[model samples]
Target: MKKPSRIVNFLYRLVGMSYVHESVSEVREALAEHSVGTVAERWARIHAQGAEKLQHPLDFQPGLIDLHDEMHDMWRYLVALRNQASRGMSAHLADELEEAADFMGEVLHHVGLAAEATIPDASLDRGPGSTWINIPAPPAL
Candidate 1:
């Protein structure tokens, strides 16, 4: 694969992973900032939303998809930040940090959509296309 393709694949994978991590951490962090009581109430409401979705099929919104993309972008930006930070120059990150921060803002904006369970199969790009199967038959049946 080409370098750009590889990079894009890396970003997509990173985003999926981050989605799971952030979802779980948010509940904890939110509780830390607010109180357990308030967080518990929010959790209950979120659980109800999940149950409703399971009970009804056509109620999904575009916001959830947008949030998925934004969260993915945030993960990509974070990977970029880590790479930039490893370059060993304060000036390097200084230039890239603003963009990363902007991406982080997007993640925060779509915070509620992040899933607390397993990372969904939704990917950043069209995933690898279906592969063909090969069969070997008898030479002369």
Candidate 2:
């Protein structure tokens, strides 16, 4: 298997360090505890912090710009959720949060694939039926 690119490896590490999984778990726990008031607050805080922390690194690559923008969108969604929660928990709020999470997950999936893409190396191939050939280097004067 081809090794992941440096960007991909870095992003994976950042994702791990960002406590995304823990935040998700916390949201679930909040739901179980009927603490919907804090759910949006916590979600917004986590994603906003992640976006800020990653902004500089992500800005260094053009290919990463879209992912960075998507992270901002996630923060916006969380803010919307917070607004919805302020009116009291509703099934609609739950559905919206779930949908937002799913979208963010999809974005992360694409980021992983983009980062893991193998760069083509022309030297690795020879024409059909070609035998190995070595060229000697010239001696330095």
Candidate 3:
């Protein structure tokens, strides 16, 4: 019955489960500098990678975070993978994005199942934990 917090909503968008208006011009903007041929090639390659890639089974245990700093590693690895793909520096994502998205989805899913649990389970922190560092929000364009 409760709505997702702002932080959870941000995660949703990050994993491509939600839509935002700002990125609507993404392809057009990309084409501004690169030619149609280059864009086409990259798009095909990305889709190919998505299909051909075999993501290893995620090691997410339970609850919000793991002791191995999996959340931070997932974020860092995903950004590096995306950056590499974006720059055309590397097509292999190492399945990091899928892993990160799965990790985040596990977090959200854990918080979500709280309501369905037979016993009370309110101990979960639905957002960033106390040990998690704070990063200032980026300046609005």
Winning candidate number (lDDT) = 2
Summarize candidate 1's per-residue lDDT along 1-141 as a digit string, tens digits.
122354676787887832232464665864575656766778767756654544222223333555677776776777677667767767666556766777676666555444322233455436555333332221221
Candidate 1 displacement at residue 13 in angstroms: 32
Candidate 1 lands at a TM-score of 0.30
Clashing pairs in 2: none
lDDT of 1 at 112: 45
Q: Rank the candidate models, highest TM-score first.
A: 1, 2, 3
Instruction: Name the regions of candidate 3 deviating beyond 4 angstroms.
Output: 1-64, 67-69, 91-141
Q: Show pairs that collide, candidate 3.
A: none
Q: Rate residue 104 of model 2 by lDDT.
A: 74
lDDT of 2 at 82: 53
Model 2 clash tally, residue pairs:
0
| Per-residue lDDT of model 2, residues 1-141, tens digit only | 244565876888887743232466666864665545676667767656544543333232334545656775775777677567657677777677767767776776666555333223335645454323232232222
Local error of candidate 3 at 133, Å? 25
Q: For model 1, name the residue pairs that clash.
A: none
Question: Which 10 consecutive residues of model 2 have the lowest summed lDDT?
Answer: 132-141
